[model samples]
Target: MSLASQVGAVATRTFREKLGPEILEVFDKSYKNFTDVQVLSGTHLLNNHDVVVESPTGSGKTLSFVLPLLRILQNSPEIQKNQEIGAIILSPSRELCNQIVSVIKPFGEKLNLSVETVTGGQKVEKNVKMFKNRGVNILVATPGRLFQIIQHEKTLISRCLKSVQLLIIDEADRFNEIQFEDHMREILSCIPKQRRTGLFSATQVKEDDDLVVFGLRNAKQVKCAQERNSAAPSTLKNYFTVCEAEEKTSILLEFIRQKTDKKFLLFFPACNSVRYFQKIFERCLTKRPLFAVHGKCSNSHRAAQIKGFSDSSNGVMISTDVMARGIDISDIDWVIQYDLPKHSSWFVHRAGRTARLNNCHMSRFLDKHEKVKLEEVKVPTHTSLKSEELRQKMIKIQVSDRAILEAGTRAFVSHIESYSKHDCHIICALDDLNICGLANAYALLRLPKMRELTNRKDLDQFERSSIETSEIKYLDPKLEKQRGEIMKEKHEKKVEVLAAKEKKRREKEQRKMKRFGGGRGGRGGNLKKNENLKRKRSEDEDDTENDIRLLKKIKRGKLSKKEIKNVL
Candidate 1:
């Protein structure tokens, strides 16, 4: 009757009896029981019914779909070994796709099912060859990569997909995003309509949403009562503090210093910001290992960094939203949000990274002006450092190196641009941001030229570095030497252009003189032409003077019909 006893009771009825022996064998080692979402979802999917599951983080959403998919594939008689795919799972990001594959792979190995992934940051050719070389019974892919492969190997992949018996779209809410919508539609069209479909997410999907394109036929909607209204798990403790922009980094450093042994995922707004702050945190928090993940990182490098951080018991990862969703990194103690996400819904996703399958905490440092934005979310206020503790330590960072200086400037500019586009514009409005304070927070040597700072009055608070940014030298001698050669080449090109313009001007002048002088036969003839031009000018001047004098005399009553006629 109690919660623990109910879970234990539910445990006996789920996973052990329903799943295949191989799947049950794997689940027995770790999972005591399936979560409510997993239990109900598997029941519906086992009956060959389409399902849309809305559940909270850490609710076993991945396994909810994975269990059914593996069972369906095992029973499917239409699937051909090494020739067709039995199931296709569409995820939003490369990292999430990888996570899905990881969850399914253990069961796959035991059941003799083949699983493979196709996502961006890897060669399309490599992914194409996967279908040719091995039997991919289950394919986990990002929409973009899947669509790309479909375009390149339309004949081959399309043939494999024609035989697909199950379609699972993980994090289905993200598929509605503009970047992935078209790709999802194209992929769905290629999949057969008779197959079972599942849509899963931490957020709720409305009845009239675009995800209906996934072709749910009388799809049973499954909502977990335990965490239906919550985006994060009950174990997550959220604390926030309001501070000036310049004090953000200092406060973050203080937080990290207090918990050096714990792992952290520090969220930034963009890739440039991630790269820039990765360098800063590396120098500042030298004792703690640091990793960076963004869209720009190569597939190998990003995966390697994630593996390194995962292998270590504790470390820091600075990243963009690429690492926000469906990434299962165990033992992460904190999720520090350095900047608000472009969309408020993503706030839940960032905080969801921690408190996953365990107790964890998230601390959000809101800009002073942005404190009001949290009125709806209602995160409790937490203690922050005293005024003295939030001292300006960023100045101690070595920005004399041009690489550091440029990275800081780029990060500042990109952060400003990204801030202006926040979906929660009321709280993260651009007009409220202190450009000068933010630059200081980023440890910028000089304010970057950005539209946000153009013709602004509050910039007086920021002291422009007396050292010219152009004068800063790259730390690498080879790069510095290369830059010098480039500058020299540009200067020489400019000088050549100036000399050519001057030559053109002299030639133009000489041509005009030659045409006039040749018409009058040389120096004497040129002088005669000049005198004739002057005499003609003198006669015209005399005629004008005589007419004026005659008109004046007639006005004085000295009368003359000739004078009146001339005036007329």
Candidate 2:
């Protein structure tokens, strides 16, 4: 199945119109209305120009680069000649690679364009056989897997990459991180210098070195404006509920109950947590069952779980940071960061999963710790988004009207049964990081806890610095007690070893003295042995005294720097 017609042959068509009518028809068929960002970015890519797109998540950023590249490939005579590879697309994970494939594949089949995803999880043998038998027009891949193929499959690399015309790196911020830079650079080095390049990401840092490595020169900077303080989409509603650290799990459960009407994507800290929460959610009467994706899960299992989540109308996709970087799924009503991220910038990507395509923005949920970290996070506001739109959302609450009423009515079940009055109330803690003199306390959180802490009266009782430092201490203790124990144990072992060696040497000396007692072990022989021992002790003491005198002389300026070394 392939289109024999040439695309975008209209007279003096504008850059946006050059996307071709066939693509517009596909967009309409998919119930997707192509946006301004897509048109502008697509036009640049079609003109063999480089672009760095910093659009909000869910703004059709994928197609912005993909469509034009695809259109160019569809019309190229070289592409038609045995479907010689014309474009190479790279993302961080196979899940995203498959998602991008989902969009390009169906439309590609109609255009007779061949797109193949080569990821680390898949078997290279299959890819080798496929590429050997057929030419791939667009090879979407992850860095490591593609590099592996490049090293082993020289024939395939030359066939696909030597003449490649375009390279697209999605989630540019993630790929630019320290972890991916080397491989990204290696991949870049392999590509032709005349290639058109695009780096698309929802979250971007201005000083990222990854951008420079992309070899983007005079690239068009395309961005979609969102009205919010965070780098995430303004449509996203951000909130943090205070509770005991142990209560996080129960709170997440209660949260799911409250949002049963919408879908959810929960982010956990590690693989065990993802599995732990998924198992817990399984026993409950959740509107939809839970699914998990993590490193431990097989590639097929991850793909199945992601597909299950995407295809289902209402369900929870529990996962670790593995799913955080660059994945787009529809109707992810809420993004819950199960734990605070190691880097503040990650919040943008985590929250980006929701409120995609400006669908009423999305909702982001955080606990006390995560919320505090988020407040401390500072990204240089170098975005093209309008400044006026970045008003502070932290000071104000953004929950649904229904949520407010439900809270007042206590519609949801209590997270846990409390038997004791101690540790009763959750507390609101304020943290102000006074970096330079520019520190200002901005975010305020209300913990659902007791009224006061032993007559503290209110939140003002706790100083901001005290609370912030206390949190740091709580999360990461100094380990002073443990360190001292380790040092003491080492010192004792060293002393014991030396004492044993000294005892053994003394015993050996006594044995030698006995062995040297010639011509009958008599009183005279014993007297000689005693004298010898006393003389040896005196000689040792005298040597020690001489060394001490030399040290004193050096301290009293009796020895020069060179003389001191010789004396010691």
Candidate 3:
């Protein structure tokens, strides 16, 4: 048996002996056995020791801390149901917080622990009211919403936090980022110092790390050993395919067609690409259920899409890295990365989406210009080229639908901008991008006005859409008519604003002409006269200073050669 499997067996044995009867019953029904990291981390956590768990994604990091904390809460004599917060889990994103809440709520219910969650998507007033009336024992929250509540409802929430025995910072690596550090600090300060803290991350944390702000007290560091030092689950089969920019969608379509029965999570670097491709896939893959979500989506929209896709037996979810961490979706057959993630850590997190409950596969599309050495990573290559039939279909779709055409251009531009900001610049250099091919891949109607494409010669050779962009109409007649009316109104407003600005400019110029005797030469001559006067005055001042210096030198009976030359 493998080290991981052996560890799991040992963990299962330990859990049955230590965990409460209710939890153990649920555990046996839900999970076969505890994972390697869970076993190592749970031991320290159950002993009331602060822990820092550094494990790969899909290695059951969530349950590693969660189960131990739940047990602690269950066993504690001082804990009161719905009257005090026993434990609090801090997550970076709303989806992640919701996922964490979902996992814990069921277990909390089984254990008679009341679980409550506060995230950005819901109304703050409602959350506040819920906390005040419903109360909570275990609170799962995003840092932003939690911090807001603490800032506003300090007395009530802080009082609840005083009873918090455990604090789990999920995706601790993300909190270490500059954007979230301050919020983490504020949230940490609010929670009682006496509470048990558990810092969990998929990425390996160094002995010397940025997590010092959270201030773990002699924290037991638990890191799970993996095969080949991979940050992704050992069960995940990673693959890559090198293709031109335009060929990406075609290849992705072909791959999806080949695996029609499999559930897919497709990652894009930017939200616009997710939205664009989601629409494209909706039209092309008619039978398959499709959902698109990203950072830009509204709370209700994101929740709906997440729920819709989660309930789907075989569906495709196109999204940004927002869904990368802490989302616990089961039976995901494949993770298709259409674009390289900005950070290497995100790549592992994306792959971790699959292979959670069982072995799964992940495939990434790399532009030919990207020089990442896949051989070194042992990622197998998919050798097939882009399909011409799919390419023709994509072109036809873009040409016919105005919405698709516009979205394609925006997505293409956003991709270029996103690509330029990649952390691995040496491997995915912006200068090396095949702009023409990428534009072709997007089926762009015409090149968008972006600084990246300035003075590019390759675009000359690329075939653009024959139909004028203005002539293109949206597929829905109502939408097309509304768009036309809005465009006309905007144009009229713009013309009026421009005319007003022109009138003001003419009036200002007339005043200037009148002030300077009403001719082009009059303004120029006055400006020249002023310049001469200022120059003459400056020279006179310099000479006067020189005379004073010369007299002073004479008094001292000394003069420099440079001073004498200027005087002469």
Best by TM-score: 1
Tens-digit lDDT string for candidate 2 (404-520): 222311211111111111121222121221211111111112222433223333435323332221111111134545544554565455445655665676678667656665446
TM-score for each prediction? 0.80, 0.59, 0.76
Model 1, range 1-568, lDDT digits (tens) per residue? 0111123445537544667687888877767656777777887889778888876677789998999888888776456444469889988888888888888888888888888889887789999889777577888888898999989988887776888889998888777778887898789878888989998887755455565778888888887635332234545655565566776777677767777689988888889899878877777788888899999998889999998888776788899988888788756888878876786566666777452111011122232322212221212222334322332344345444777777777888899999888766655667878887777777676776777667788888888766546667889899899987886665455445645665575567557556665574566768877666566547755765665565455445465434444544
Please give the distance, in angstroms, between residue 414's alpha carbon in candidate 3 and its true position after superposition.
2.4
lDDT of 1 at 324: 83
When sorted by lDDT, best at the front, the candidate numbers are 3, 1, 2
Measured with C-alpha atoms, the lDDT of residue 133 in candidate 3 is 76
Give the alpha carbon lDDT tens digit for every residue of 1-568 in model 3: 1134235455657766777688878877877766677777787888778888877766778778778888988887557534677889988898887777777777888877878778887788888887677457888899888888878887876766777889999988777667787778778777889878888887644446575788788888776646232234655566565555666777677677777789999888798898788878888889999998999899889889988989998898999988888677766888877777776566667777452111011122221221112221212223333455666777688778888878888898889999888776766777777887777778776888788778777778677767667767899899999987876665455445655665675567556545654345655677776566566657755765665565556334364434534654
The model with the greater lDDT, 1 or 2, is: 1
**Models ranked on TM-score:** 1, 3, 2
Candidate 2 Cα misplacement greater than 4 A, ranges: 1-16, 154-156, 227-232, 283-288, 311-314, 353-568
lDDT score at residue 154, model 1, on the 0-100 scale: 86
Candidate 3 overall lDDT versus native: 0.73
Q: Each model's C-alpha lDDT? A: 0.72, 0.59, 0.73
